[model samples]
Target: MIFSRKIPLYEFFPKEFVDIHSHLLPGIDDGAKSMEESLDLIQGLIQMGFTRLITTPHIYGSVWPNTPEIIRSKAILLQEEIQSRKLPVSLSFAAEYMLDEKFMQYLDTSSLLTIKNKYVLIEFPNFQAPLQLHEILFRLNSMGYEPILAHPERYTYFENVINNIEELKEIGCLFQLNLLSLAKHYGTNVYETAIKLLKAGVIDFVGTDVHRKYHLDTLKKITSKKHLKLLETPFKNNFNLW
Candidate 1:
């Protein structure tokens, strides 16, 4: 896990990689605050060698309350800006849906938004795992949505119960590890948990999960050999779900 030499961030990433999780949409949740910031973030991603970006904004009910229409509209505006600027990166939109009572309502009404029309990026509370986690995963499968759990390493509740994550995989849930988590941006516990998951070979995709310019800066500085090794996995970034 120790890197004898520091590799530049851009050199670490594969040119074909497509980021499937981010918060680049302006003024929508906790991502970029305006179009200027969004543009800057996109430019950073372009410089980092990302060819396509499926920016996922937050859709938490109590806080964000972002609907599909709202998310799409913001994405359209951002897309127009990118097009006008002639940015090289292709852009799309999805949501990091918070699993709560409101999400259940959306699922019940069949109104949930998905990434690439098939994959749904979801997260639970960071402090504690949801009691109905199993039931929710089963329901998502029954409803025909491929669920990708966001940043499982950041969830402290799963630290001791790593087997819960294995069970989730057995039940068909995919895991997305945050790129910054591998850099220990969140701290040691999260970093170790991410390494554990990567070693287990359960992570299906990697994402920036970017919320601000600081995130992009951190990504540029990451030099963890473990992170580079994990990126060698056959990630689903090119999964033709889109």
Candidate 2:
């Protein structure tokens, strides 16, 4: 026997939800390719009832190499366009830093950009755990930045050692789940892990991590009741800090 049910994502995804993760900056990374596309994505988010957006473009050293100046400059240009068009949404910029050697150098010599001057969104390699993961989180905390580990459910390294997530939380690391993962956009394993984390109450925040229109479309197709209920938690989404 086989059975299935579907629920519209919009039914559970609050229109007022504050989105703190996205890549709508044009020509910066692997997200929007041009100004027009960026505007289109922003407008789409507005139509979806999102009141605020903190678009975080990737700051991978070898691939993206985006500095705070570069990101803010592009954001300023985008902001001007949004104003001229009178879009009814608030937008801001932060960077998703890859925990790599280059980032360590930045930690030593430069000030890292953060979300709302408090939270820092960070990521690791999908397939392997970094050698100095604990040290990095400790340093981030010592520097007064709340480190939010982006998409912990997507990391295969944690598949066999899921308990490590609790260890991370004990040490002040917050987990930001990718909204698409709940919708099964990545795969069954990711979707299952997302649900597990949600059930465990380890998910602190959720984000679109949207790179294009299709990502938004996939989110709209999500029909999981459990995923909707998980959103009810006090996810620092609308926190005044952002």
Candidate 3:
């Protein structure tokens, strides 16, 4: 199906829309607290017309301690539930890995999860970026893993240092913006940065980054033509992931 740019935000989603990042996996991170909440959130996304979701649970260190095996197991359980209900949705799983020592260990030793074959979804600390952020990205590129940096606009450090963001783009890092950031859900700074990134045509993709119902609720309010116009440039490759 073809999507026209004139669609309103609330009705923006259609069956072809594939959300590449979300935290609907139950009990895995700071996302949905239980299976019930997870299913509810999935249902809400379906209601909003999202038929395909790559629900990414946090794989932070011992805080969440989610390994690939654990994520696969949990993902299977959720898929089964969705099937039992006969919901018209396609659920898949990857992970939003935090850039830290633990992530490096995974990168060095184990098979890290991917949004697709070689595309990994990653996030930086909200407070600051890792000291060896460039080195880490270089290593990923060398190893043939395409790192999709999630929600680049939400990071406080990048808010004032636009050069850092540009350098990332120059070095082959793909940027994913949180949809809520466009609605000022994070803050004015994030909203402005998201707009700037989109307007600059630096953002490669967009996702819900939804941790709870509040996020989904806020996403529904993104009705401005300006915002929708900006979003038109992104998520263009989301369907290709399938």
Model 1 scores a TM of: 0.93
Give one digit per residue, the lDDT tens place, for model 3 in 1-242.
Answer: 99865544858654489899999888989999898999999999988889999989999988889988988998899999999999889999999999999898998798888887888999988788988999999999999999999999888877454677789978879888898897789899888888888888888888999999988888887875777677776756777766
RMSD of each: 2.7, 2.7, 3.9
lDDT of 3 at 108: 79
TM-score for candidate 2, residues paired by index: 0.93
Rank all candidate structures by their lDDT, best first, as comma-separated numbers: 3, 2, 1
Model 2 Cα lDDT, one tens digit per residue, 1-242: 87766767655556567787899999999999999999999988887667788999999988999999999999999999999999998888899999988988989988888888889999997668778999999999999999998999889778553598999999999888888897789899999988888888888888889999999898787775666677667244544436
lDDT tens digits, residue span 1-242, model 1: 98677776557566567788999999988999999999999998888888888999999987998889999999999999999999998898889999888888899885667887678999998677777888998999988888999998888867464688888899989888898887789999888888888888878888889899899898888874546666677344544434
Q: In angstroms, give how far residue 210 of model 1 lies from its true place.
A: 0.7
Residue 125 error, candidate 3, Å: 1.2
Ranking 1 against 3 by lDDT, winner = 3
Per-structure clash totals for the candidates: 0, 0, 0
TM-score winner between candidates 1 and 3: 3
lDDT of each: 0.84, 0.85, 0.86
